[model samples]
Target: MHAPVPGHVPADRVFAFNIYGDPRLTEDVQASYQSLHRDAPEIFYSPLNGGHWMITRYEHIFDIVKDYEHFSVREMQIPRIENPPVFIPLSLDPPTNLPYRQALMPHFSPKAVSAMEPKLRAFAADFIDEVLARGECDFVHDIAARFPVSVFMELMGMPLDRLRDFRALADDYFKARTNEEIGALGERIIGLMTELVELRQKEPADDLISKMIEFQVDGRPIALGELQSMLFVMFLGGMDTVTNVASYTYRHLAQDDALQARLAADASLIPRFVEEGIRSFGVINTPRLVVKDCERFGVQFREGDMVLCVLPLGSRDDRRFENSAEFDIDRQALTHLTFSSGPHLCLGHNLARMEIRILTEEWIKRIPRFSLKPGLRHHSRVGTVIAIESLPIQWPV
Candidate 1:
């Protein structure tokens, strides 16, 4: 059926590294991507999730992602062509996608994020205060998971009352045991978004939803479906990414006391510490659909085939990075595909950074120092975003 797997990659080299489960991330899951890069050929076929070609090095991924004509980001799941309604802007490629990004640019800009700092800090403080009195906490649920979700709820003007319900459903969506289960949870979220959109239509307000409703593409308001899809993307992303990266970063810090102490001593390094954490632990290996039959990096692909641009591999490429495995916060000017490169670079990056930076600052200022609870292990899950599930941590009060 498919053009006999690309790159002449031996059936032996092809591996199913269980993007989400296997070799579950310890101190850092990006290590798994690095391990994949070091061990496999530049390109190999894996029958893991319905047999897709995996790119190991950064060079190829950079070129491929920028050139979307050959590779489409429309599909993420393998062996399964399931759709819970694709998110817009992200799903749209180039020229057309630019306008949608432009419309939202102002809301996510540095200036806008700076203005929101007070609210962001307050949210962080509220959560930290709840845990500060208690010497120990499950950093994953108590902080990492709720912070971003709550922020998104406030930002999008979603009902404040439903934040907890939405967050729980989202958590379940990622950790769902079966495809059907994830599908059901996804539908519930989408249904709620539909209701929110209807309410906003009759009575608009000062929020992302209203802002989006004002934008007209080619002199026409965005279709309800398109608008809902964009909102869905924002909701889905807002709930997950920061939670994942924050947990992973803290887990790394939890294990390394010296680094943790250094960060506490010099809060100025928090930004770089956050940057390096994102670089090494950016756990998503973004998937793209092969729209038409073509050859890439010495491999032939067919229409409908899938290619996974393992972002972690690109970010940790040894050829471009020295000591790629070692987590160095003060490393020379960092270059990475952690937020992705090219057209699809994460638009929410600014907000995501602000959240992580503030949280790191707050943690260092308050905790003095902390570590993973004894005899407990940290775990990570892979889906749209790679999140550390439960980071049990303890600090002397």
Candidate 2:
């Protein structure tokens, strides 16, 4: 445990332990972000893990990510790893990342994702109908979480029954405050993935996992350990992220009747609104290592130094937009760093958009009006990825 350096986060703010715990569930996270921006402009050091620099400014973060040569994603802390840690394509730098990414791109291409839309929309409709019939429900657990997790499972050919288990494992692994807690959950997920990988190897199927099993580099298959890590990363990353985006977007849209009505009236605008929602609800801005001693935002950093980039803050940067803080669905010429900027930009971005688009459209078509309960409480967990535990909303029959 690290102590906060007096004035570490600026005079106006107090740090919230779970800023990423479940981004949609917490209110204090916004306060912490505001404090960092208003008082500590360039960077604020977190007391977590003896502290690491958290960059909130837009240009500062963009500059860092854009110049991959300066900031490397390699060597990032992955919950339960020791010296000479396990790293996958996501954790790899340029040349190494390029091949694996190329090998996988054909699977997530525009044509490929477009082909998935019909199946995804069918899934979305069924998911929405389940909640709409109830008249009221916990959006996160019942609907938001279910849709993406199920879709990903179908895409990956994982047993749909294990969706809840996977979520539980991922939540545990990500929200673990202690190393022991993380290790216990992480090892379990690895075991499960390993079993699935072995089973798929024995009798291949027409799924993403099977495809990975079939993919080769230099006339040999990609290693099973790396494949398991890759799949695990995809599972956890996609599930919580889509869930948070859905929950936050619902919360934000419901709060402003005018905005909600606008979206409800114009279904065509749902996609744009979803993009803005993702931007505003920007979850994780993971850390990157300073490959070599370098100066960023005028601050000198050592070779092995770490830097945290908050995507939401960067999305709300005034330098990038006319009004960064204000939410504008119709805001033309909007460019946000929520998905990040660079080679390591989210690979699932297209799929994420498709999921959100299908979800929002189907949701509005069914339940066009809703509001938060008078005294609903939100639960947020801030970790490497921010998430929403539950989003409670109500609608008429």
Candidate 3:
């Protein structure tokens, strides 16, 4: 059932699109989102999720995300909760958010990510090897989910033994419904992070967490609150986004024999393939709080109202991408809001790209041919992140 529309929202602008549990997401997530572009206004209000605005067009999303002055990042979640979990830099607006983001740049920089490529490649190959002999496997669970999580665990110095536990928590957090459920899961996550922070404080190690604990923001040592917030966001990013993207992209490749052969034959095209895949199957829905009453994008946005930037829709916006729906590896000037844009642009994009590139390169090098097991209908779940819940594929033994 839809929530009552607010007085400020025009009747034409109200569209009951539920970002979290929309039925169409399970059938075809990207196509489900694309329908909004055809059916709804560029910017409309959704009576679901406590009545918030949905920004479908690319230009408007770009402008709103960058305009921190107008659209604040303070309360990003829809169906607004009391005292939501804090994600450092992400939840903080510009100027205030800048220093924390700057401190993180060197760590996630192209150079730093390059340094980790060997380990990333090894992790990818190892996971591939585990499933390669079987000739049939659930790609999403067997490889897509485990690979990046393992790499992230190694980077953060988390124990491999707890990989499943941590992954489960991350999964639960995303799938959680209701404010209380989300909050409870968030606290449990923070509880885990708090332990790690305390342990790192006592025994400093050569890891991302230890390095971050040493970061100084505004000429002062980062406080515990800020440190926990940074780690919290890192945990979420490290665990989920890449996994979803990998599943979606591979599912696409599994269906298209020609595209799979092309990438397998020419490893050089793998990078372009990664870029195009991310653009085509981008999986993040970022929300922003309308800071002050404003008249922009030809609509009225009241203060404290939440606005969700439908990021995947932005990448597929025809105004920016020619033949945006078609997945063309040769598409030139391929820029997208997949990693978002502006001050809060995703910090881990370099690592995410490298992980996906290496994994694809390794998979194609080994299992050069594979496809969805016949008659298999993969399941998907959509929330802040859209994911293929299961993907069974097979190849010649």
Candidate 4:
């Protein structure tokens, strides 16, 4: 069984607000780390999550993530996550990870994702068209969040209208403040996923969900619970990630007209902007358990110790980056740790990159400018996943 981290919290270190206790820990994470990384690059244990070792600097954190043999993904997930922790292949170490990833790899390849682009672009364009005439709307509800939800639903061959229904629970699941609440959200998504898997098993549509159901492992069909969990993870990862990326860009660009103009002037720069935006706002505060005792970065960890790596914080580490704190879109910072590093690097990364790049390009191409509406407050919460609750904005009709 996993136990709380054992180490002394440095006297100078101010404990970060537990990402689990409160959802607000995700927003402005850099500022939070800057407060801690000075005196302690690696906190012995954080008060958050019962004081797991918090990796604040880039070298130590990425090095651990890249070296999977020493730092395993098993039991990396919190027990409170919605789906049973079994679909946690992304959390799995190599050799074992290879087969599970292989089974689902076909769905996210460039060719497969590219085939869906026309449909995705059309969906994004239609979404833009709806909001373009309105002049003012919450970009989160109105655009940024909606596009990926619709795309994932379509990709899974699920009903498009059910987007709102799934999103309602998804938002709750991702923002679940308590372990009990997270479990309830998981039950809800699992119920929906069960229905989808059963239907797809019978119908076998030409979509990712059906393809996954047909995915054979060890000469037998993968079990329904496993398949459902995979679908749930896929839905959660795809929908939440792209939406957050778009929201990050819009929130930042809405206030920075000069930066917006620079991108608008050269649409080709949108990819770089998206990459940088991810570097700035990407939220994968995942943890890994040590397979055996190991030493790195002058710190030694014993077997079974949980090591938590904050991805975006590492991207800003001054040692690995030049002027790391500055948010220069053009700053070539070794391709940010946004998507993560090494073997278990996010599988949906290519599709996510394409979706954000195209959506940013299209949105800026049509709605060139926008501003955050006055008197409206935008709230960002950090949990297992970081998210923007609402983002209201106005642009020319």
lDDT of each: 0.79, 0.74, 0.89, 0.74
Candidate 4 error regions (>4 Å): 1-17, 21-32, 77-84, 177-179
What is the Cα-based lDDT of residue 322 in candidate 3?
92
lDDT of 3 by residue, 1-397 (tens): 6888889888999878888777555556886688888888889998987888988888988999999888998997778888876789899988998899999999999999999999998999999999888999998888988999999999998888898899889989888877889988888988999999899999999998899889999999999989888888889888989999998999889888999899878999999999998998988999889888998878999998889998999999999999988889988966799999989999999999999999999999999899999887877778678878899999987
- Summed backbone clashes in each candidate are 0, 12, 0, 2
Tell me how far candidate 2 lies from the true structure as C-alpha RMSD in angstroms.
Answer: 3.4
Worst 10 residues of 3 by lDDT: 23-32
Candidate scoring better on lDDT of 1 and 3:
3
Q: Higher TM-score: candidate 1 or 4?
A: 1
Candidate 1 per-residue lDDT over residues 166-259, each given as its tens digit? 8777778767645788678767877888898888889999888888888887678888887877887788788888888788888888889899
Of the candidates shown, which would achieve the greatest TM-score relative to the real structure? 3
The local lDDT score (0 to 100) that residue 381 gets in candidate 4 is: 63
Candidate 2 yields a Cα-based lDDT of 0.74
All models, RMSD in angstroms: 2.6, 3.4, 1.2, 3.1
List, residue by residue over 90-145, the lDDT tens digit for candidate 4.
75577766777888778889998898889888988999888888888888888877
Q: Could you say which candidate leads in lDDT?
A: 3
In order of TM-score, best first, we have 3, 1, 2, 4
- Give candidate 2's error at residue 334 in angstroms: 2.9
- Residues 1-397, candidate 2, lDDT per residue (tens digit)? 5555444234323342223342333363443464456655466555556456678888888888876787888756522134423446677888777777787788888889899999899998987787777788888888888898888889988999888888888777767756566567777877888888898989899899888888786567888777877877777776677877777777787788887788788888888888888877887767787778776655666665557788878887767766766678878756677778787788878888899899888888888888887787786777567776777888899
